[model samples]
Target: MKTFQEFGLEPKILRAITEMGFEESTPIQEKTIPLAMEGRDLIGQAQTGTGKTAAFGVPLIHKIAIQEERIVALIMCPTRELAIQVAEEIGKLGRFKGIRSLPIYGGQDIVKQIRALKKKPQIIIGTPGRLLDHINRKTIKLDDVQTVVLDEADEMLDMGFMDDIQSILKLVPAERHTMLFSATMPSNIQKLAQQFLRNPEHISVIPKQVSAPLIDQAYIELNERQKFEALSRLIDMESPDLAIIFGRTKRRVDELAEALQKRGYAAEGLHGDLSQNQRDNVMRKFRDGSIDVLVATDVAARGLDVSGVTHVINFDLPQDPESYVHRIGRTGRAGKEGTAWTFVTPREIDHLHLIEKVTRHKINKKPLPSIAEAIEGKQKMTAERILDAMQSDAYGEFKGVAIQLLEQYDSVNLIAAALKLLTGEKKEIEIELTPEEPMRARKKKFDVRSSGRRVGGYGSGGSSGGDRRNDRPGGGYGSSSGSNSRYPRKDGSNYGPRDGSSGSSYRGNSSSEGRSSSPRERDYGSGSRDRSKTTNNS
Candidate 1:
């Protein structure tokens, strides 16, 4: 394995890597770095969390002269979250070398990005559609680009950005080195490579071996309506020390966080739109265990190294196999056992098979924990807590009080009452989450046969594509479908009215005054979806 220093990187890039706290090269980094530095067009098949960024980034940074401007390197990612994540990591890797990397994606202010363009960054990371937009506007000049990378190329293909990718490629110099990384290689991806790359060196890492062996993977078949309830029950049963819930989009993250909070869980949402300070605070609270659950989109949670994450729940299945691996990788770190549960809607089973094939692991199908099971799990935790207290001699002061209580009540009853108090029976919350357009299903070519019972967007009947929209609630973020975007949005920019406070409360109408029958309808139909239900007896 080659080290960063052995790869002949400049002192500034090494300093930046050291400052970022990385010492060892992950397998992809070790293999890809040497070839990338040699200026070979390379194709890397590696999983996320395997440090592929540094593999492509190090060489890209090395080739950029301090005086070069107008994007010496360009990276196109599938989503805004990923675009920002890659840009941030690339910036960190290139910081000391005077190599500036900027993230340009839809749903952010084109004007703001235009202004940033004026600063003349050396590297540009953007989603396909937005990058094309910048190209058309003449805001980004790719003539100086010496290298270009398509990170998570499969995802962009799945999101229908292939045409845009080709269009952007045409604007750049055809002589640049290109690195493409994807966990699964579809034929279309191969076609794109063939069209753009010049006899690339193929480096394929075995996918099944990439994931941590300690992580236990499972799936629960659930209908969309039962999802929130199932998640609540699962939390009661699992009692994770710390957990990260992955949602597919920004709206899903915001809704899940709000719903979890309403149910009295110490939870918060993290996405691309949050200021660095806000993202930092949420992360701090999560690392310190102040928050039991963190709801986040994939982009926002990238590069996170929190060690105590005991569980990972895929509230919504990701678009491709690579994202599934990345989501599950958050747990099962530091040689510790972890659990990952994905909620599969009946329609999304095919996509699940795709993930299983790419990961080469059979995810065991698990029954959803019922309300009773949740109660039992809580009681077990209480029992363990009591046993621990006894072992630790924590009852010295309470012994006399316990004796006094025993005299008034039967000892067994007193113990049962104590357990009941500690266990805390589960509370059912009726939460209405705003439904999102399910991710585009991969064409039949990517599907591989698997036996796991599937649900959600991976089910057999799942909706694949929808016209993209960017209107989201709160000051939170929205997923840009490679089109017009207004990003770095303020509290006032969203559809739902806000009072400009802590980011809650509807602006126009209260959720209490019965309005629309569904969350999506409420937003689009100018009404509200009340959690309160009125039953009618026939």
Candidate 2:
């Protein structure tokens, strides 16, 4: 890693970078900054959290002349959230130089963006759809644009934005700097680069294993009916400060979030069906620690950059290895150690293995945590809290009452009572989740001709095994299409019908069709008394 100052950055820019706590350049930044500054077209292949934003942002900001106010540079992203995030980072980098960047995206008032355009920002960061809209409406001009960046180019292709990107690129000046960044370079991306870039330098910073090395990866094999219980126990035992739970479909995200909240956990769901404002609120709460768990679909969580994410839980497996890499990449950022756990049904073991083989990282098997273990973990947490209070001398006011009780009862028993009161008994809530069909392992093939579809395998939306159009409302970019019938179960039995039918009931220790109250009452023993008997199979 090289220092930012070694890149010959302007003093003001270096000052801003230093203030932002960027002491050294990441691999992507070290390799990209010099080439990009030398006015060459380039393609950068790197995953999220690799500091790609700054890798491109620094040079873009450095090149901007504050005197020329009319959109000198344009950056196109796939999602509104990403557009906003990139704009904010660029804003910080350019603050000292008096260069301005404005973010334009859909789901916000176009009138407001048009007004902001009047202020003559030197840079424009926007989604492909909204950018093309502005182009057609003559609200934005690209005649004077000197630099163009396509951030997350592959993501835009997944969302069916290739044509829009082409149209936008055609409008830019013929002789100008162009840079494309993507996590994976599919045939479509390669063809696009060949057509648009003039012998661009290709730089790949992807690790041998796509997953971050700092992430401790593991998986638990259990039955479909046992997943919720397994997840609850893991959360109890791990007690992650902040966590993300990935689900396969919109319905799955909703059900899991609701079930988690019902169990007295602070959680919320993020998916495409949410309005922009609702999505913003959920992300805000998760970022501010008001909520500890975020349940999200793959597309909804795309390009999300939140710090302090301690854990990533795959309640349902991703559709492909790339998506798996993206899911875990949310945690273990900035050289911080994090944990990731995946729940695999017995039938889906081969699929999990497939992910492992492709990513070249072995996922260790973890036993399902017993209910008694969860209780013990809670007691440990309570003890830590008590010890912290003691160290802080915060128990001074309660010392008199403690002394009074100590005289009457054994000190150990009184301490146990305090732990019990602080660590409330686990709620015996019957959480019902819609069981997702297990994924089957299959070989992937790359298709170059398919620009509108996923190149190698199913899109994120296709993993739901239903109509992709219905999963994403408004037919917006980032909507993926595929059929679930491609892979059949090993038992020669097909998955449940996609029709909104209750395929099976996931009641306590039962996989029967209909719900039974008596079974749950019998299974949920009184106050963890019989919980030790609950095995992993249960």
Candidate 3:
């Protein structure tokens, strides 16, 4: 129940905290802030959504004296995403105090980060890998670092950053305060604390039961490529007023946003590569319903507060349990119920179990709804909308039009037509997502084999149940090992078998396909159908 002001933060920082709309301290913040502010080592065990960033960030910002020395508080994170998120949260909390923070991570330009470091930010937030990179290159100095924080310590251990963390810790002053925050404290994390932390006061904030309590969580067991189609179908069926789709990588976010836009959904992508202004604009659009769907990476979506987000879709399953919890937390706020759907590749089932163990939430297995079912779902939405309009007295203006239309057509026909117009009819969208590297299973050979059979050998490029891999010319290739030669023609050609009267081998070239279609082209088939549906929806 403590407020930011009670935490003894300076007036300017307090003012910024109020402006940022944080009135009361979260459990982790309330317990850890005072101790951290007193310049003591602390360990906080909390999940991602418990507002742990500010728990450590506030005290770090408060204790630091902003100057050109570029040495005050250091935050080390496991991933570039988390590093950027921690830096962003620190930047927000320290805005009025002028206690600047810079994020250092790989995949971004090191020269730019070095140039930013020239600004002499008092706080440095960096991923373990790139922080070490900067230290080795002599671009960053840690001699004056007074406080060190290892955010998501367990994640760093999971990512095999233990050695790098030890090396980084060695570079910092031993007398400085150290804070470690992690969702789970494995033995390695405990060892890390013993080695570096000086009798830290432990604070454990129990993770909120967001997934199972207020949110309905389900998984669609799908192939990597089929995820998008399944997502589109779910969106149609669910008809969520607003939705957030989480993708694993920035590229995935970009492609998903683009593909959703092509399929007539107003969507935008948010990631670390985007400028602050760009991220703000995307969030703004999401809030105002200018964009109904937000496609984002976890780092970019962190700390976002978009209300009325009815659904959270995990286009790709997150790599960690904390991330899964964070992604689903976007919805089901303010005691409202929300739904979350995660698209799980066959190989990542074990990872899903790991997540279930951490979050203590059993996700239900949901079959992918067929296109016809999606249409029915949309029609149901339209039916509800129509009935509500009729009951709410919003049909007064259309009364005369209805009467005139009734004279020309039967009432049932007219009503059906109106419903069709209102409904978002089924559409076939050809989403061409670049295949992601298959997830590597971490299980015993017997476990892997059993799990593989359950998901229909999707990881091994075999069909799931009766869902055969299409053997057409443009049909998908299985894992790189098996080529089209696996389905050889009767004439010993690499391509699938052709007609019985074939003189030469069936040359399944693009030109040959086009020529075959050109002679008596009366049908464009799925391509035209998809395009027509897209145009109608638009």
Candidate 4:
């Protein structure tokens, strides 16, 4: 790793980087910055959290001339969220240089964007649809554009934006600096690069093992009916500070989030159907710790870079191995340890193995947490909180009440009562989720020449070669349910608020005497339980 100073960046840019608390450059930045500074076309292949923004942002900011108050650089992203995110980062990098970057995207007022355009920002970051709309309307000019960047080009292609991208690129001058970045270089992306980029310098920062080394990956096998109870127990036991739960479809995300909230968990859902404002609000709450869990679909969660994410839970398996990698990458970032748990149905074991084969890492199988274990985990958390308060002397005001209780009862029993009060018993509310069809592993062919490596698409079913448009709704590529239907209404009844008046309970557990059976006992009929735990204690 190298410092920003080694790249000979301008003082203002270095100062901004320093103030941003970036001490050393990531692998992508260290390798791409110097070549990009030399004004060469380049192709960078890296996953999302590899600092690709700064890798290109630094040089892009340095080259902009503040005197020329026109759009000299253009960056294209796949979604509105990413467009805004990139624009903000670029804005920060260029703040000291007096350079301006504006984000133009759909779902926002076009009239407002036009007004912002009149401010003469030096850089423009936008999505393909909105950018091309501006270009067609003559609201944006590319005559003076010197640099063009295709961030997440693969995602744009997956969203069926290749033609729009081609139109935008063709309008730019032939003699210009172009950079393309993607996590995977499929055939179409390669062709797009060859046609646009001029002998681009190729740089790859993809690790040999695609999964992050710091992430503890595990999977639990159970029946489809048992997933919700298992998830609730896991959350109670793990007690992650911040967690992301990935679902396969928009409906799944909505239902899962609603169910979590009904269970007294602070959670929200993100998917393509949400308005821009709604999406922004959900993200703000998640980032600010107002919500402890975020339930999201793969496309909706794209390009999301949130810090302090302690866990990633796959409520439903992703459609492909690539998606699994992207989902888990949300955690274990910035050299921090994180945990990922995948719930696999009994029939989906083959698909799980396929993911392991692609990522070249083993995902350990774990037993479903028992209800008693969930209670014990909460007890441990309460004990830790008590210890922390004692160390900080935060319990001084309560000492008199504690002394009174100690005088009335045994100290151990009083302490146990306090823990019980603080850690309320698990609500016996039943939650019934719509069972989704299990994913089947697509049959793959191995190429002997490539050392028996699998060839072609890995269960996503998109064309491996060509410029075909992905016609999936909501710009998502995978097995997501195409329907935009809301959660199904049962018996023509609407669900009540979280007061526990109505809704299903855990059917897999016995409701008699308000006690649930252990998962192993319920599922396997009194088998020897595996009590091993692999969650991060920190």
Candidate 5:
């Protein structure tokens, strides 16, 4: 709870943080800023919502001179969404300091990145694959980089960026200060740190608690094809005062919000692709309760501190346990009770258990609401509205019309018409959302109990981990619908043509092409296990 000024930050940076409404430093920021500013190589271990960006950003910004043109600080991330989010936050921290940072990632135009590189930004926040592309083309030079940070180091290893990360590090000046951050220091991550960092300081903030216990947690076991219908019905049933719906990607958020609106929900979408003005506008509406539901990607929801959110729905399950905790943390603020619901495909049932294992809390299973049930819930809400209207003096002028209508029509029938008009087509709206590949959860061990219960990874049996990859023709933004085959990715080896059906060891392949396949394949994490029916080992 200490102030930013207590960390020895300069006046300009302090001003920026204050303007951003961040008067106090979060746990990770409190421990990291002083050490990072001392030019010490450090390893910080913290969960997703812990404010790691400013932990590294403030020091990097303070070290750079105003007019220095060379890119002095380099930050690497695992996803384009993460890269963009980091860059935007750093841009704010350095706004008055005259430091500039640019984000480079796949799916965005490479020509556009090249143009941006020409502007001589002082910092570059990029994904490994896209950074390698720029390196191969000789567009980005790290010769002058004074500080190189491997932000989310474990994620890079998880995503199969070990080689790229090593190569990028080798290219930077040998004397540079290096820092690495991860949520957990697994064997691979520890090895990377030992190989790359100096006698680095280690810091960690493992959250020992979960969200408020007053919040109700539940999950709906359903099929992917029927998820939207279930979601529409659930909204009508719950009637949240304010809701936040978490989607996995930008495309998913945009489409889901649009479809929800078409189905008669007051909703808006928030993602990293939006400009600051647009994000601000959306946040404004959400705060004032103008929009009842806000559909968002994880990157967009990070560090958002709004109260009065009654429900948080994971329309798509998160990739990690940390992300799941963050999504649900949006609600249950200030001792007020809240509720959270997750939609889990059958194959992902074990994955849900994995989340339970991590958080050490069992989520209750809930039945999907039926259409008639949803209508009944709506009818109750309408009746409440009618009662409130009947008590209020504001309806005095309309009494004559109400009497006249009752004379011609049955009183109950006239009220039914009013209810229908108010609710406006509560169910049965056709919406087609392009299917997204289900998230892959980590595996620890698989076991079968005598009562027909399976826990942990559940091995390669039972179900093919919900083989919905075939339905995802174009999973990402720039991919084409003509082929389910992953596009040729910028980062090689993981997506396709790597080592046959053995598949890519890493989770995310920055390429367009997917994984190799035999008659049967498994998706653990986001590793490419393309069911393309063709071998990917070139």
Candidate 6:
């Protein structure tokens, strides 16, 4: 209920917050800001969507003087996406004050980073690995750091970056304030606090519910083979302003995106294999309303913050309850009501139930939409548009044309013609997706990171899921080890395979099994589809 002004932020930072549309402080911000501004080491335990970025960022920005050009604050995250997001948020917060923040991460060009470094940014936001790389190359100096943040310490530990974090922290001056944030604190995270922070003030902001209350969650039980058809029907019915379809693997993202395109949906694929530029372009298109749907693996979708996502479709169920929460959380943001639908295979119903139990939210079950219903959905939308136009008196321009057409035809026939023109015919596209294994179970735990999403939940991939060693081509995991969601997600967790083994042996690669990339060959309605602009975001 508290406003940013209550935290005693300076006028310049307050102006930026107002410009960014933040009127009130989130629970995390309400608690952490005052202490952080007082130069206290702090630890905040909260989920991603709770405004933790500003919780720490505002104070960090407030402390840094515009006259000091050296790096005074450094934030380390587990992934490049999170690093970029934090940097952008901090940059916006410090805009009016002329505080400079730069993001340095691996996938991006190091030479460019070196050039950015030369600009003497007073703050640096970077992933641990890349930060260490720069530290080793002597491109960065941290002795001037007045504050250091382990943005998602648990995730860095999960990704085996604990040593790097320690090393980075050690490089900072001993008299610096340190802030660490994480959703869950295991033993390792506590040890990290003990070593790095000086009697840090702990602030915990627990939400009333783990999942977003504004999201209307539902699920349809169906066979895996029938998923694409069911999803297409749902899309036709809902016609979301913007939607994200979460796939379990890279191939699933690619195949589903292409399949949706085949059925006349404006969709794009996002996965780890995508070049940074390609990822940026796809995200740009999604944010600008050029793409209607984004099919993505969990890793690829991490740290994604686009508003106006009206719906979140679990084309494939997430690996765990936490992921389910995060997946649906993508929609229903900015206090707007959103819809989330999951496709549950017959055997995966139990896994869905497990997710329900953990998030303490019930997922309504519904039957797959039939062909007639899909057509009816489209008709209903067209009718609504026409009615709105009539209400607004905007139809006056079309009244003369309507009268002219009616003069030559019966009113019923004329209305039918208008309906036909307005409602697009349902496409009978035959989409055959490669079957994937379901998750072993839904027992895997997800840490709520500062960026508001898990950094490494997609099993051992970077930002998006991919086998880094073999350079495996798949972007999604639903078809890989996480397939067969009927079982537990973690190999050895209480939800693991009943046989007591990891169950990874059954997973297989389907890429060798023939697929046509040329969308022109796949007939959707009547003509060849043009896919020259299809992005290889994967």
lDDT of 4 by residue, 251-344 (tens): 7888899899888889999987899899999999999999989999877776688999999999888766767887898999989999999999
TM-score, candidate number 3: 0.74
Superposed Cα deviation of residue 444, candidate 5 (Å): 11
How do the predictions measure up, each by TM-score? 0.73, 0.59, 0.74, 0.58, 0.75, 0.62
- Candidate RMSDs in order: 11.1, 14.3, 13.8, 15.5, 7.7, 12.0
lDDT of 1 by residue, 1-538 (tens): 5667777778999898886667788788888988898889989987665677788988888888888766788888876556656777788788888788888764445567778888988888877655765676577888888888999898667655677778788988988899999867999989999999999999887644555689999999876667888998898899888999998777778899998988888999998888989999999999888998999987777657789899999998886665787789899988999999999876567667767776778889999899888887778878998999899976899888988998899989988999998876455666777554333344422211123312111122443322113222222133233433211211111222222233212221323322222211111111222221111100
Candidate number that wins on lDDT, 2 or 6: 2
Candidate 2 lDDT score relative to the true structure: 0.75
Q: lDDT value for candidate 4?
A: 0.75
Query: Model 5: residues >4 Å from true position, as ranges?
Result: 15-23, 79-81, 105-112, 127-137, 158-167, 186-191, 210-214, 271-290, 299-305, 319-326, 347-361, 387-427, 442-538
TM-score of 4: 0.58
* Candidate 2: segments with Cα more than 4 A from true spot: 79-81, 154-162, 184-191, 218-235, 239-338, 341-371, 382-538
Model 3 Cα lDDT, one tens digit per residue, 188-282: 98999999999989999886462548899999898876878888889888988999998877777888899888888778998888897997888
What TM value does model 5 have? 0.75
Worst 10 residues of 6 by lDDT: 519-528
Q: Using TM-score as the measure, which candidate wins? A: 5
Q: On residues 1-538, what C-alpha lDDT tens digit does candidate 5 reach at each position? A: 7899898878999998887658788788889998999999999998765678888998889889999998899999876546766887899899999898998865555666788889999999988766766777788988999999888887677655677788889999889799899988999999898888999999988766545587899999887778888888888888888999998878789899999988778999998889999999999999999999999988788768889999999998886676788789889987999999999887667678768766767899999999898888788877788899888868889989988998899988888899998877754567778665554454333222213322223122245323233334334334345543442222222233222343342333334433232101112112232333221110
Candidate 6, residues 163-216, lDDT tens digits: the string is 678888989999999999997899999999999899999999877677888999
Error of 4 at 111 (Å): 3.7
Error of 1 at 209 (Å): 3.1
Q: Judging by lDDT, tell me the better candidate of 1 and 2.
A: 2
Which residue segments of model 4 deviate by more than 4 Å?
19-21, 78-81, 96-98, 105-109, 154-163, 184-191, 219-232, 239-337, 341-370, 382-422, 425-538
Task: Quote the lDDT for 141 in model 5.
Answer: 87
At residue 311, give the lDDT of candidate 4. 95
Per-residue accuracy of model 2 over 1-538 as CA lDDT, tens digit each: 8999999999999988976657889899999999999989999998765688899999999988779878889999876556766876798798998998898864444567789899998999987766765776698999999999999898777655677789899999999999999989999999999989988999999767767899999999887778888998998898888999999888889999999998888999998789989999999999999999999987777668889999999998876676788789899998999999999876578788878876779999989999888888788878888888888976778878878998999988888888899988677898767566566564332334344333223223224233322322222222223322211211111222234344321122222212222211111112111112111100
